[model samples]
Each structure stands twice: as structure tokens, then as C-alpha cells.
Target: MIKDFNEVIKSRRSVRFFLGKNIKTSIVKECIKNATLAPNSSNLQLWEFYHVINDEIKINISKSCFDQPAAKTANQFVVIVTRKDLWKNRRDFNLNFIMNKFKDLKDKKSRRKKKNAVNYYKFLIPTLYGNFLKISGLIKYLNVSILGLFRPMYRQVTSSDLRVVVHKSAALAAQNFMLSMRASGYDTCPMEGFDSVRVKKLLNLPGSAEINMIIGCGLRSEKGIYSEQFRVPFEEVYFEK
Candidate 1:
């Protein structure tokens, strides 16, 4: 087991080449379960993972990716998907969790806190997540922008903005999955080069769902490390508060 967190992080790389050795699907699934521990916006958890190991499915997916070496040669694959259309369902889930959790508490302060949280899921969430086309979002944006001129306001209200929110959450889950894989002595390469439309069809996903990233999974081959790792100087990207 990889006990050193630092080593696990440092050892992870986009492995484009993989050995022929087989990896246990159950291990990968456990890694995915670990992925659910990642933080997400609104606790909505608007992500899904598809573990693709079937040979026929893998071949088709690789073709959708233009047979890129990263995907074409990998032993297995995990497709991260964002389901923004399920906002209401997720909101309800949170609400249900809150209700069940707070139902037994008798303290007045706890009751007040529960009421506030209930209102958040019942009213505030619907206000933000309930939108049609871009019309509602555009109106909310203009209203919020004007309000912000006077006082602090939550500005990310547009439909596009919400889409980005879902994508960001999915990315967090993807990173969690990758790190967990690394901790398990597996290799991965996250790729967005695939035809998302075809990939979704192959997976039988609805049009409302979006493919966040496809991660190739296996043990690294001799040629896996294509080049020396490089990054911009820390001083260039770092900032002092």
C-alpha cells in the first residue's frame, strides 16, 4: 500500500503507454468509491463514473478518441460524466438527508438551524438551479450585477455558469479517482480528446449528461513517461495574500 501521500501525488503522471498485465476491476471500483469523498458544489454530487472494461466497448471508445495511444493501449477506462439536469433530484436528496437528520433533535437552536437549511434547499436552491434556456439566468445575472454594485452578491447564476460548476465538481471527483488509483500502484491518463457525442451514445447516456473526462487505467509501460516533467516556476504562479 502507498502510505506516503507525497509520493503518491508525485508518482502520478499521464501514462500513455501501459503494460499487458491485467488490473482488478474491483480495485478500480474501490478507487471510484474513494472518489465520492471529493468536495462538490452545493453537495449536489452531480457526477457519474463509467468503468469501461469490455473489449468491444473499449475498442469503440478508443475509436471515438481517434485511437489516441493514451486510450487505445490502456487496459481499462473510466468515463467521468456530469449530470447537470439532475439538480432537482440532488437537491431533494440533500433536503431529505437534512430532514431525517434533524427530525429527532428537540433543541430550539437546532430546530432553527434545521429550518434555515430546509429553506435553503426548498427556496434558495430552486431559485438558482431552476432556470430555462438562458433567459432566466440572464435576468438573474443583470439583477445580481446591479445588486452587487450596492452590496456583495453571489454572481455565478447563469446557465453556463452552472454548467461550469458541475464540470468543476466532476473534475474534483476525477482527480480523487486518479490519486486513489496512484495510491493503489496503478497508472492513469485523463483525456478529453474523444468525441463526447459518440462516447455518450456508446454508454447509453442521455443528451443532458456531459462527458467530463475519460481516464485510461493500467500499469505504465517502459515508454509511459514520454518526457521529463516540467512546470512553470512556483514564483510565477504563486501569490501572497
Candidate 2:
């Protein structure tokens, strides 16, 4: 399983151009499940993903994203939206898994302790407060900071460090989806350049929801154009533990 996953990771690439091939809903669902399994700040599952299959809606979104040809060409596209309310509360989906894992370990003891632990996390204010303090750094950096209180920050790090954290999480999810797609004989592109506000408006997003990036998925076409870009060597990009 590890070898297969590594192979998928190594073979996956950004496929900007695609063939007119429809992806099965099952595949999309599987990819989304994998994406939701991605790590998040405080186990807070702040992300909301939209799978756009309608041609008209896709066309409108494509225009909103500056008419990127790849956006329109994909058989299907996925938009990642981050909920502001959820971010403010610091509630991510992973937290539930974590709490449950701990609860299971505790359940081996007594029913009373198991119930107490679950209630403490599920309702107790102090437990939540403690959890908040533990992951406070993540909150301060991922929410309270970055993004000029004015616009969404993109590019390398820069001012939107918080947004970058969310983007990194979303990007990891997207990469996981892409690798799964590749393993299933599909293609994908992780696009960064886009107008976030315009995209939000086009998608009728909530005030708290932020549009991060779009992923184009489909089959590669014979006419697809791929640029020859060099990736940094391991020595230049990593350090031993």
C-alpha cells in the first residue's frame, strides 16, 4: 500500500489540459473522502468543497476565475471554500476523530469515565477552552493573522501566512485527490492564479466562506501542452531529522 501510494505521488503532475471525458461520481466521492481525511488546524474541519459538474456553472466559474482555459476544459472541477465562522470557532473535522480515538482508549476503563470524557469534549466549556489554548498558536497564525484585512493573500508566504496555512491544508487535500485521480487513470491541475472575491460572488459564497483554489480534473488530451520545468533537488529542498 505504501509503495502504491508513493508511486501515485511520484507520477502525479498538474495536467492543465484535458480530454472530454466524464468522471464517475464514485471517483469524486472517494477523492473527497480522502481530502476530508487531510490534516487541519486544531482538527477543525473548516473546509467546504464544491464539486461543479454543470457545464453552465462551470463556464460561469471559469470566467470568474479570469477565464482560465483549463478551468473550462476540465470534465469537472472542484472549488474549496473555507468557512469563516468555523475558523473563528476553530472547529475542524479532525478533532472529532482525535477526541473519539482518545475516548476509545478511555472507554476500556469504566462507562462513567468514558461518558465523562465524551461529555467534557462534546459539551464542557473548559475542555474546549483548554483545547483552544493548546492549539492557540495555530489559531493565532491561521486565523487572527495574515490576509490584509483587505484582500486574500496569494503567492509565496508574504503577508497572508494564515491563509497560506489554510491553502497548504487545502493543497494537501487537492494533491491527495490528484494522486488518487492519477492512480485511477485520470488527470488534474491545481491552479493558483484566480480572483478570490470574484469567485466567491460567482459561487454565491457566504460572507465567511473564502475561495482558495480550483482543481481541474479529467483525461489528458493529445493536444495538451506541458512545459518543461525543473524541480529542486532533494538536497536543496529538505533536511534530515
Candidate 3:
């Protein structure tokens, strides 16, 4: 078994071709469960994974991706989606978890903890997520930018900024899923080339939900790996301050 995490990470590649053999559903699902453990903003976990197992659906999705070899030849697909509009639902879930957590404790500190947690979900999340014609996010962005001048402030406030934030967290989850698959001796290819609108409709997801990336999963074929890995020199991209 490839026990070394570094080796697993290094071995993972965007395989464009896959073998005819199929992978077990249970194994893929377990890797998806690992994806949920990825760190996310405010513990909201505004991400959803759609595992496409149906023959017709995968083919449809492949076409939506322009019938690229990566998607066309994939045995299955793991579609990562960002659900920023579900913030209220996730916030309430977090509030419930926090409430249940403090119920067993009998201390003033615990009460304070519950109060802060409740306030964050009840007040702060709505303020950050609620928007009208993008004006509210605009105002919030300006306010944060001004506040940041005097002190450290959370400046990511606009709707576009929040979109990026949710997508980033979803991408992190996708990475976790990919790494877990690599460790399990499976291959995956993360592809951004796709018809987002058609994909959303195909998946029956809400319009508010955004497609983060579509990952192709299967066993690599004889010539699946298209090229050797390449990277810029460390000095060009890395800096210590």
C-alpha cells in the first residue's frame, strides 16, 4: 500500500483516459465522506458532491463538458458544487449542534460559548449572506474596507467575494476527495471545462448553486497520463516575508 502521503499526492494526476473496469461504489462513497472532513469557512460546509453512477447521466454530463476525453472516458463523475445560498440552512444546523453541545454542560463558560455561537449564526451569518440587487454586499464591502483602514477587519464582503470563498472551500473538499482516491489506488481528473448551466439543470440543483469543478474518476488506462508534471522554479512562486 502507498502509505506515504507525499507519494500519494505526487502520484495523483489528471488522467485523460480510463480502463473499462468499474470501481466499487462503497469505496468512492467512503472517499467522499473523507471530503466532508476538509476545513471550511465558519464550519458552514457550503459544498455538495453529486456522484454520477448512472450510465446515461455520466454520458450526458460528458457531452456537457464538450465530450473531452477526460470526461468522455470517465467511469464516474464527482461534481463539486458550491451552495452559498444555503448559508441560512447550514447556519441553523450549526446553531442546533451548538445548542445540543451546551445542553450537557453546566457552567457559565459553556453558556457564554453557546451565546456567542448562537449570536454568530443568528445575526452575523444572515448579515453576511443576505443581499438585494447586490447592493447590500456592495455596502458591506465598502464598510469593511473602511473599517480595515483602522483595524483588522474581515474584508471579503461582496457577493462575488463570497462566491469565491464558497468555491475555495468546495475546491478544498475536492482535493481531499482526490487525495483519498489516490491513496486508494484510484485515478481522478479535475476538469473546469463544462457547461455550468446545463450541468446545474442536469443535476437538478438550484440556480443559486455554483459548479466548483467536475472530477472524473476511474482506473487509469495504459496511456492515461498525458504528460510529466511540471512546475515553475520555487523562487518564482514562493516568498518568505
Best by TM-score: 1
lDDT of 2 at 224: 59
Question: Between which residue pairs do clashes occur in model 3?
Answer: none
Residue 101 in candidate 1, Cα distance off native in Å: 0.8
| Superior candidate under TM-score, 1 versus 2 | 1
TM-scores, in order shown? 0.98, 0.69, 0.95
lDDT order of candidates, top first: 1, 3, 2
| Residue lDDT tens for model 1, 1-241 | 7659999988899999889889999999999998888999989999999999999999999999899998888999999999999989999999999999889999999999999999998998888889866589989999999999999999999888989999999999999999999999999999999899999999999999999999999999969889877899999999999
Of the two candidates 2 and 3, the one with more favorable lDDT, higher being better, is 3
Candidate 2: tens digits of C-alpha lDDT, residues 22-141 = 888678778878888887654556678888888888888778667676776888888877663465255434345546666546444665766665564465322323334656545544
Question: For candidate 1, which ten residues in a row score worst on lDDT?
Answer: 125-134
Descending-TM-score candidate ranking? 1, 3, 2
lDDT of 3: 0.92
What is the TM-score (0 to 1) of candidate 2? 0.69
